[model samples]
Target chain A: MRAVPRCVPCVLEIAVNTVERAVPEDRQKEAILAATERVSELYRMEPTPQPPRLGTEAQRTVMKYSEDPDPYREEKRRANERAAAVARELESDLENIEDPEELLKRAAAAAIVGNTIDFAVAGHEFDLDELREEISSAEFAVFDLKPEDLRGARVLYLCDNAGEIALDKLLIEVLVEELECDVVVAVRGGPIVNDATREDAEQVGITEICDVIDTGAEMLGLLATEVSEEFAEELSSADVVISKGQGNFESIPEEPFPDVPVYFLLRAKCEPVAEELGVEVGSNVALRWEPEDENVRRWREIVR
Target chain B: MRAVPRCVPCVLEIAVNTVERAVPEDRQKEAILAATERVSELYRMEPTPQPPRLGTEAQRTVMKYSEDPDPYREEKRRANERAAAVARELESDLENIEDPEELLKRAAAAAIVGNTIDFAVAGHEFDLDELREEISSAEFAVFDLKPEDLRGARVLYLCDNAGEIALDKLLIEVLVEELECDVVVAVRGGPIVNDATREDAEQVGITEICDVIDTGAEMLGLLATEVSEEFAEELSSADVVISKGQGNFESIPEEPFPDVPVYFLLRAKCEPVAEELGVEVGSNVALRWEPEDENVRRWREIVR
Candidate 1:
């Protein structure tokens, strides 16, 4: 989504957090100020500042000043460890579910609850201890697709943050085993904020579940022009795309895949995203962007 | 208080709100963009961006772009009306108290609770209906002076927002009639945000209660150097200065009124102010800034 005036502070906060994490104690202030300046420069220069783009640029500024390619390396490690433990505890619960659709919803809810692990979004507070309760009580503000919609389909799962990916593993397992879908998980080509990388997915055992690919860009959202041809080809050819979080959901254009059924599974963590989805902030959202009628018709024909 | 990274969004939100209120619908985007640019400029230029200072400058940028002197004129008028109604409803409760100390605390709490009317502070939400309940429950987080301390002394009451000034009227009455303190209520000389002006004080009947003066400048917080000489003199000569709201508390230097006891009567609405006062955010604060020991000694001598 395009940046609103409110995004200015949120983006600055992301910059400040990234800078503080990247730079030494003595140089943090200088780096933070410089990153803030970069945010200003982008807002001035761009006709419409895209929040994710601004955040990515600000993160770039912090990296440049600190001379650290991966500022969130340690943070990602910690998040992964925490999420892995939670996922381990949740595995038995998933195993107990009999019906495929019920198991799919349960796992999807867990995945959306896990999106709260995102540190890039401003003012988002996640309590890992409350995960089970949140998942159990989770209701989709928008549920456009059923588990049967993706049955035996080629599903491309887009990953968001490090800790969130551990729970995404649960969803991936459900899609592969319960729904009988072929899944290819895509992580960020490089680190930008706390977005999951290939290493993060591997650390969380996602590589063992299915094929893993990179977006071939270290940006906030997926820009069509910025990704690798292979990834672009995969995006277009996949029968359904399970977008994991706000970044991927935002980056994907309205009509990027006209014939593809993309399921956005995330918690509407901020006002803009919430507004865009027609849901309350903090609501668990599972939406399918209305694609061209021909695509829906084609998908139904295949299902029949 | 020096602005932290968190203040960036807050200051930007203020600018956006101000510009939206001031400028035409067609020109709002242009004005907002320009105001954001100004906020960025100040952050880049100033060694430490004071949020109130940044806010004032951002408002100035909005005024310049919109070509309107007072963007909050209508908002202030509405706030005054709302606050006045609540004050009228609260007058009997304030008047019913027999013990002078209890009455003073009640009036002070009402005044502090009324401070929730401020619109400039980002994320501050106040309900006019809840005023009475809040006043009843309000407890000072850092009350250094007793009601007896201001007895028969010169008290310069610095007013904050428009609606809040009406409640300050109640506190002023208690100070005058109960404590027998000589009171002078000071407001901003020019329009800035929703901060009280001479007109607002008069509209709220603060003029009828006691002597009303102006700070002789348009700015956020009271920068001693920027205010008129008359205000500076009043500030220095007063036996006890009763400062109101976050802006005034932020602007007043740690040791500015070293020879006089300055009672900062405000709601610690923001994190910076809460940290400065060592209280939780949203706490009612009636702190006597610890002045030099000589001032306290002399005040006790006078009391004896």
Candidate 2:
């Protein structure tokens, strides 16, 4: 997606958030400026209606001025612990549910809920209790693909954030043990925002249950060129891909993966993403698409 | 005052609000781009810490693309009616109070509340009842100026918005009749956002109370060069000046009036303003500064 007018402020805001995390108060202004200076340049270079690449750019800029290489280390650790505690409490109850589809959708909703509560985000902080409440009520606009699609098939679960990965682990458990699918979880190559790393996978014990790999995209999204051969092979071999949150929703455009059944389980967190999908903000979206799947097009035709 | 990085999103957000009100949905994109293009130019032309010039610029860009010249007219009228009804209810009880200082501060706070709750603003639409509730809890950071400052003095009240000036009536009542001060109220010469115009002043019954004049600033502040000699004279001759909101705070620099005691009765609505003043968001600030007021300087020194 390319840049929109709304994105500038958001980019600057993200820059402020990233910078504040990295540097002292006095040094934050310069980092923010460094990020702000990149806004027009990125918009000019890229197309309109993009994800939070400005955030990635700002994070990169902030790294230059930062004292700590991974400023979100504490936040990531804390988010994982808190989110894991919630998951640990809920796992038994979720596992006990008889209907498998209900269980999967609920897990997807939990992932969406996790996407909204960003402690690192400026002006967008909310509590875990609120997230729990939001999760319970969230209805997806698209959740057409069933558990049968992934049953006994190779599933690739692309993780979003650190704290969120703990919740994603609950969803992964359902796929691995219940559906009998061979699952591989792919995290980011390096530290960028709160996107999970291989270290987070180890801490969250995601590595213990299933094989975990890292897409070497230093940014939030997965690019084939940026990933290791092992990651690319896993991605290409997977029958069904569940990409959690907005970052993967941004990077992995559907046209490129036409043959792969790509299911996006995310909340439409920003305006551009929401507008592109023609959904309202805070929309619990579980968009599903493959070369043969026609539910989205059929829905559009019905609407038109 | 100049532009800050934080202002980019705010300007775009304001542009979105302004354009959505005036034009059809399709035209909003173009108008928003027009406003965004002006951001770099504005910051380059102006300085780093400006107030709501974004509103002014957005309105101008929207006018270029909009069918309606003043999209905020209906909102302005409704706001004036709602605020006036509230004012009418409070006037008798407020006037019955014997303590002059208590009465003035309450009125000032009411005006600050008015500066917020813009009907034309996208995410900030609030009910009058909500405004009344907010006013009840609102406290001042600085309200040290005594009633003696206005006693038998020529007081100039520079108005901000349409509905807000109606609330300003409560404070003007204290200044004109109770304090026995000569009062002159100046509004905007033309339509811009909801900035009070001569028509709004007349509609809200400013003509019935005191002399009402117009400044040609078009943007919400008083620029001596933009107004007639009559306005310049009224501004210069006033013994005490009460600037209603942030627009004036942005426009009226202290260097121009070294001798004048300018009392800014406002809410630090934006982050930039909040940070500069070292106050929290939604701070009801009644900041006072004269030729040599040293509290602000001393406080800055203490902070540094």
Candidate 3:
């Protein structure tokens, strides 16, 4: 074999491939568009190599594993176990609380502290005091929140990635302890992207602290597929719904439950969503509302 | 909306979209695997801060334009015109020659040089003398001359980006002038990946030198669908086939023509192919011959 010249087409192959595997299955088209934008941004921001080579084999291997079914399931199982354990721990905390509002406050505090530790280790940084203040001030004035609304509400905390499971655990604890909510921490049924799987949740003790379920590997995001019969019953009867990550946002249509108060937490990593929110890309968001009402005011305030 | 801090998942969504686009309709699963391999490689090589993000809106816009029906047809039309022009130029060169052996030698040299320059820039550091010496020394070689066989030849061309289309132009010239072979110069169908497009080929006068075709809008690797009748006829009658780039290798199957000789010119950017070749990933290669018993000795020597 004679040596061929290294060229631009090869480099581009690597770059495109790298970006492609990073996306989840349901959002493949959106991901491709985002990758294109990022590449263009990189070119404009700096003097990149003219023709980026395709990703190296090692890189491709990692991407393959990231999307493998076994790893994803393992991650989910671990998270579920962890959530179950946390729920037990919170059971004792709940017994100690007398006031419903105070319990919610305590649960929210635990969630913040727990999630902060997890995020920090995962290489994320945030202002703890500010976050706490924000949570403390979360009033029904912005949206609608009634005691009956959250009582025994079925909450699903969809996880994202291995390292982030600990944070999800914290959030589950709050729903169970403070809100007195029936919580089900759902891990992806199989691996599609980097989202948590059943095993990952178990490993982090998330399953130990809450009821755990699988979303059957559907990439519909917030518009999660019908849960197992038992889980579905819980989901349909629940009053409050919480979905984590933008995949859920894309999958869950904006009008599924007009009356149910759903809280969506995600970072705006792509343009379409960011542009819709009128925020810079890569900004984090914690949007809450009932699909039935025109919550444009609430959305505006949150985006601002 | 409060900042959600789950941008990683959002980025994953974009990656998925990119992979879906890169994959052809029929080979979605293989394309997905190829994409996963490429992205995984990137994750392993680079740090997390350069965490993979999705394509931007601008990139998607470019992709849309590339896939537009009219532009695709126009690019093909222009490419045909360019190939005819190159044929005319080769005929002029042949008019001055009279010996069959000399004509064959010139044709082979032209094929090698033309293919090389098709995806590379002019004034590239290609050592023409070295390439010529390698081609002339080969014995018992097979030529993959069928256009149909071009569909799945795992070609890998090392590239330098944009301004180097001239190199590809020169290589196409050689394919016509020396080898007296019918050729297809494949490019990125749309603008998502940084590579020569049908338009790029037309812009650099490449269409005039050879048959111009799109490798679809694929970014991970090259994939060969059913050959067009015109190109298939050329392949059925030809004696040698040449392919360029790592994308070509990823997209196409390796043994499209079990009996004919196929030449792959690529830079090893990813692991699977590099590992198979026992070469350092990212190294360039110009591998020749059929993977059949008749060419065993030649194959072993070249691959070795």
The candidate that wins on DockQ is: 1
For candidate 2, the lDDT comes to 0.72
Q: Is candidate 1 or candidate 3 better by DockQ?
A: 1
Tens digit of lDDT per residue, candidate 3, span A1-304? Answer: 0001111122234334444445454443333334433433332322221221111222233344234334334334444444345545554554577776565544444443333333312233545455445444433212223445576676766655554565556556656766678787777665543456676766777667787787654332533223344444544555666766555554444423324566656555555455555667755555665564443333333322
Q: Write the per-residue lDDT of candidate 2 for residues A1-304, one digit (tens) a residue.
A: 4555566566666666666667776665566556656655565552443545656776788778888878788888887877887778668667777888888888788877777776444444456566666766778876765888778989898998998888889889988888999999999888887789988888889999999988766675654345666776677678888888877776566223424678888888877789877888878888885644443343233222
Worst 10 residues of 2 chain B by lDDT: B295-304
TM per prediction: 0.81, 0.85, 0.40
Worst 10 residues of 1 chain A by lDDT: A295-304
Arrange candidates, best DockQ first: 1, 2, 3
Task: Provide a comma-separated list of chain B TM-scores, one per candidate.
Answer: 0.87, 0.86, 0.44
First chain of candidate 1, TM-score: 0.87
| Candidate numbers, best lDDT first, in rank order | 1, 2, 3
For residues B184-259, write the lDDT of model 2, one tens digit per residue: 9989878887778888888888889999987755775654345666666676677888888877776566224424
Clashes by residue pair, model 1: A9-B9
Scored by lDDT, the top model is 1
Candidate 3: CAPRI quality band: incorrect
Estimate the Cα RMSD of every predicted model relative to the unseen true structure.
Answer: 6.5, 6.2, 17.8
Model 1 over residues A1-304: C-alpha lDDT tens digits? Answer: 6666567667777877776567776666667667766776776654565677778888777777776788788778878877788899888889999987778888999888887755434344556557788787778888666877888999989888898899999989988988889999999989988889999999999999899999888988765556776786677689888988887676564223436767888888888889888889988877886466754454344333
